[model samples]
Target: MKALISNKVFRIVAFADLLQQSAIWIRNISLLFYVMEQTNGDPVAVSLLNVLEYTPIFLFSFIGGAFADRWNPKRTMITGDLLSAISIGVILLFVLAGSWQAVFAATVVSAIVSQFSQPSSAVMFKRHVPGELLAPAISISQGIMSLFIIVGPVVGTLIYSTLGLVYSLAAMIGLFLAAVLVQLTLPPSPRPPERRAVPILEDVKAGFRYIRGKRNLIVIAITFACIGLGSGLIQPLDIFIVTERLQLHKESVQWFHALSGAGMLVGGAAAAFLGQKLNPRVVIFVGIAFLSCSIIVEALSVWVYLTAAMRFSVGVMTAFMQIVLGAIMMKLVEEAYIGRVNGAITPLLMAGTLAGTAMAGPLMKTFTLVPVYGMSATIILIAAFASLSMKLGGNAANTERSAVHLD
Candidate 1:
């Protein structure tokens, strides 16, 4: 029962995250639309914009992770959030002045600013929350932000379209500023200890060695990679399916995403309330299996509503997977190496996302949306098999070591 309630520090952190996420969702969608509008809906321009957005995640995630470990995570978050706000402001000013170069540069910088906080946020969760509660906490946190994701873009877009671009930019800045304030109120995380005995390169090498020493770590990394791949494809492809394939209206596209978010939110809430009793791995597997089933049905369904229902199921499953994977990550990795582990894991996921997105565009060429997305179900089934077949108990050494420490 005590686990249900977060400390003041955690509450502030959570609130800050919710705000950050809301702003990020609105910002990403707005930027994409803004770029498309500026280019007069050229596909090349849209693709380039995507490249700019995702490139930082691929390149600097490791560096950012290292920075998070080197500095105070809370301070890092505040700095990153502030940078993000500044980036948007710059873009807004440029757009108002009709400077395309400025707009493009600002958009590119925004991705870098956003990526900086990724590691710090994970570090904070590791520090403030107990391992047992980490999954549920993350699930809850994600759920709240996701719910905003369901509505923020649509409303922000409406405001942007009707009220003007400046208003949309202002709204994004306001949300980021709010997030910064909330983060400021949270208790500061103590900085990670510097390892004087080893240089940075050696430290990175040591982190790699540590992972190599554990088999479960490898599986976990691979699993996360697959998850990322699935997400990148799922998002853009699902939109394509809903609007282009199913003959849904432009406004209706938002509802499909909203339904998916709603399902994930419900699943997350349930995990937050009851995740302590469930095995983390089991939860992830169940999610994969459920998504597999949903994908199959979605492929065959002639109606748009059925696709929405499938998206909702996938969301629920993703929530469970998130809870379990997050907890395991916190539990298994050492404090010194969490940053590196995260750094390594994140890029694989990024690569996977890239792979998924890249393939999604072309795959639709060979087949209809139904059969193509339906194929994702097979991938999920593979994930379920992988999850069950892999042994998480490979870290018995650490478990034994901890037990010995107690004795």
Candidate 2:
């Protein structure tokens, strides 16, 4: 781990990633509050904001992956950062002009650009990080993400409360510019080989065929989709749990999220330590099993502290599942196809999340929170069982490269 962090490229990319992610979270949280204020707390408008935030991942991830596969990773990432800065600048302009609707437009543009940027970042990791060090590297990355998840909202809220909308947008622009500067320091990634001219649709189709040939990849994608569904089901209900079931104030909900973030940090570190010693498949299975159990336990608990504890446990287990799955993919997929494979699976996971979120309200209205929680647990447990069939080996000796044909 020490050696991995000491590597120059890793350090540069990590720093850039931290700035980029912080900017994104700050923008998202600040915008959410801005929209809430402007719309007078209209639930439908707020929900629409959430939908706008995530919809691009569903619609553009595949295309982004295809482009990432074809483009230089470093250039792709730099362009993304630059465009993000410009987009935020546009938002700042809209805010100054008192055109609130244009702020939403800027949000959509940034979200779309992120789909391209994210896969490119994945490509960079695949290209630069040694296979043995990938898990620790990813763990470090996830830790940064988890830390920001806890801090970003607080920072965004603080800025919004203290400085107001224009200043908040200016802060995000500055962060993005910092990211761009750091990204410029990254070493250039090797370009993919030029092939005979082929239609973009054929390129995407070939990526799908590659995954189709790998049973392990299929299993991982499906398991992740289930996890997304389970997460979506439980997320919206947390507010209800705090407000209705546990009889706590809505503001107290931040405690649950904070604890969960702490758990993610601890869990990521543990997974990084265990990466070389344990089979990723076993790690994923155990994480899912525990996460599912935690959800069920949280549902049954009446006390707020117990539920919070369960939320923390869920966070820890989720970090393990995410890191191990990512490590497995990095190990199996070739550098050329990493982008497309990730692009292909993203929508499956996002669709599950959207579907779960869409279903949670109706299910709660009809069957109540306990049943809805139970249903989510059952879905996650099913994913746990499905993970058992994965054939990921315990060590490098049994690992096999994915049979993906890029041509």
Candidate 3:
């Protein structure tokens, strides 16, 4: 942990992530509030915002990843941030012109830019951070994210309420610019030495083959898919849980989210402490299983406190499991392919989330919240079982790599 703290690259990247996440939250919350004001709290307009935020991942992640692999990591990341800033500027102009609908463009452009920048960040970790310290680095990263999960809404609301949408957008622009400057301090990243001079479409095809041929990667893909599906099912229904199940106002859902974020903050610390000492398969299996159980309990519980406890536990386990998985991916994938692997894996999760989210409304309409939540829990448990099937001979470094014909 000490070593991770002292690592210059890690410090720079973590700070940059901090800036970017702050910007994202400001944009997310302020825009949501702005849209609600403009549309008089229309649910469809709000839902459209969610779709804009997520659909970019499904549409652009793979291509952005391939580009990340093709470009220098530092350069790719900087370009992404710069483009995001520019797009936000454009959106600000349109807003000033009274084109309120252009606010959706802010969500779309940033989300698309993230699909590129995010994978490059992983490649930076793989290249710059030492293998032994990777877990702690990721733990710190997730911890920062969890912290935002707790505080972001409040911050965004404060800014929007006080300064209105214009200044809120300005704040986002400033944050992105700050992130770009921090990232510029990073040591120049050299492109991977094993680069193939193939067309991107061919490289993407190679990425698919790479995942297909590796047993562990295959299992990881399945696990991601399941997590996405299960998460998607319940994400849209949390409000319903508060209103119908717990007999509380819909606004009370914030407490559950806050509790979950608090749990993640603590869980990140614990996962960092455990590090490689915890067996990957067992830890993940337990994490997902616990998450499944928590959902089931949340579904069945009429008591508000019990439901909040489950929500907190879900956050803790999510942070723990995700940090471990991230470290494993960094160690397991070759630096050359990290971007592509990430790009490939992220879309699957996003696709599943979208699928589940789409299904959640209809499913709830049919059977109500409890049974729908139960089905989501059942799907997550299946993911836990899937994790057990991963065959890790030892460490991620020792995992077998798949031979691909990039030619």
Candidate 4:
């Protein structure tokens, strides 16, 4: 904890993340309430907001990552945040002009810019943070996100209720500008390598090739696909665990999310303290395996307390898996390729998520809830076993040799 607090780079990055997350939640909830009010709770309009937010991740994540690799990490992050603030300012003007429809632009523009900024931040971490502190650093990052999950919505709602849409948008812009200023305190990034006469397309393709050659990266990519599918498969059906399985009111679902968030906060702390002593792959494997069991238990249990326990356990394992995977990925990849590697792996997760989310509803209609949940858990279990094949243990030296030769 002391080491993490003393690390100048981590402090800068964490502060920037805090500011950005504050802005995001404020923008998210404010827009949600504003749109709902304007459209009289029209489901299509509300859902469109989600589409605008996520579609950019599918469309631009890889492209942004490629650019992040080509640019200076610190500069790219600052530019992305600056662009977000500028775009939000423009949207605020539109709102002031009575073009309420322009509120959707705030979600889309930030979503698109974050893809570029996020990978740059990862690259910066890879560059500036020592490998030994990587796990704790990632744990701290996850803790911030988890903390927001629990508090962001309430804060956003309070701001929107009190100040209204225009002020909320202004607040988002202010928070973003603050993030940009905080990021400016980041240590100067190393100069970017000279541009090869290579096209960006070729650079992207090389990223694919690089991942293909690394055994650990391949395992991580595959794990992401499985985790994505498993999580997405249950995303739409979680509420059913309350309404149908436990015979409780649908509103009871909030407890599940609340417990999960609390669990993530605690789990992040545990990971930070224990990370150095644990093997990353083994941690991931055990975490996923535990999560798979929790899903099955939750799906089967009619007892509310039992189900809540499972949800909390799932959150803890999720924190462990995320922190470990992030630390290991940073450790495994060279600094030069971190952006591309991140870009390449992320799409698989997103694609799996979209695919599973699209299928979950249809599958639930066709089969019982247990069967669908079972299927998801089974996929996650497979990922757990697959993680065991990673050569991070006794053959760690061999893997490093292979990675260097491939590079």
What is the C-alpha local distance difference test score of candidate 3? 0.88
The regions of model 1 sitting more than 4 angstroms off are 1-6, 197-202, 230-235, 243-251, 367-371, 390-407
Model 2 RMSD, rounded to 1 decimal: 1.7
Q: Could you give candidate 3's per-residue lDDT for residues 1-407 as a string of tens digits? A: 78888888999999999999899999989999899999999999998998898888888898888888778889888889899899999999999999999999999999899988999888888888999888988998999999999999999999999999999999988999999898889997765676548888888887887777677788889999998999999998888889888899878888889999999998899989996798888889999999888888888889988888888888888999999988877777777678888999868887888899989999999998888999999998999999998877555335465454343
Return the TM-score for each candidate structure.
Answer: 0.88, 0.96, 0.97, 0.97
Off by more than 4 A, model 4: 404-407
C-alpha RMSD of candidate 3: 1.5
User: Clashes in candidate 3: how many?
Assistant: 0
Candidate 4 accuracy as TM-score: 0.97
How far is 154's C-alpha from truth in model 3 (Å)?
A: 0.6
lDDT of 1 by residue, 1-407 (tens): 35536466558777887777667666667667777777898888777777887787777776666666677888878988888788888888877888754555655776787566777777777887776677777777777776776777776677667766677778878988998888888786776654565455565566667676666677777776766676556656766666665777777777777887888788788777777787666777887778778776766676876777787877777776776776677777766667777877768878877888878877878886766666666666776767774455546545523531100
The residue pairs that clash in candidate 3, if any, are none
Candidate 1 TM-score versus the reference:
0.88
**lDDT (C-alpha) at residue 204 in model 4:** 80
Clashes of each: 0, 0, 0, 0
lDDT of each: 0.72, 0.84, 0.88, 0.88
Error of 4 at 85 (Å): 0.9
Which tens-of-lDDT digit does each residue in 312-376 have in candidate 2?
A: 88788888778888888877787778888999986887889888998889989999999998999
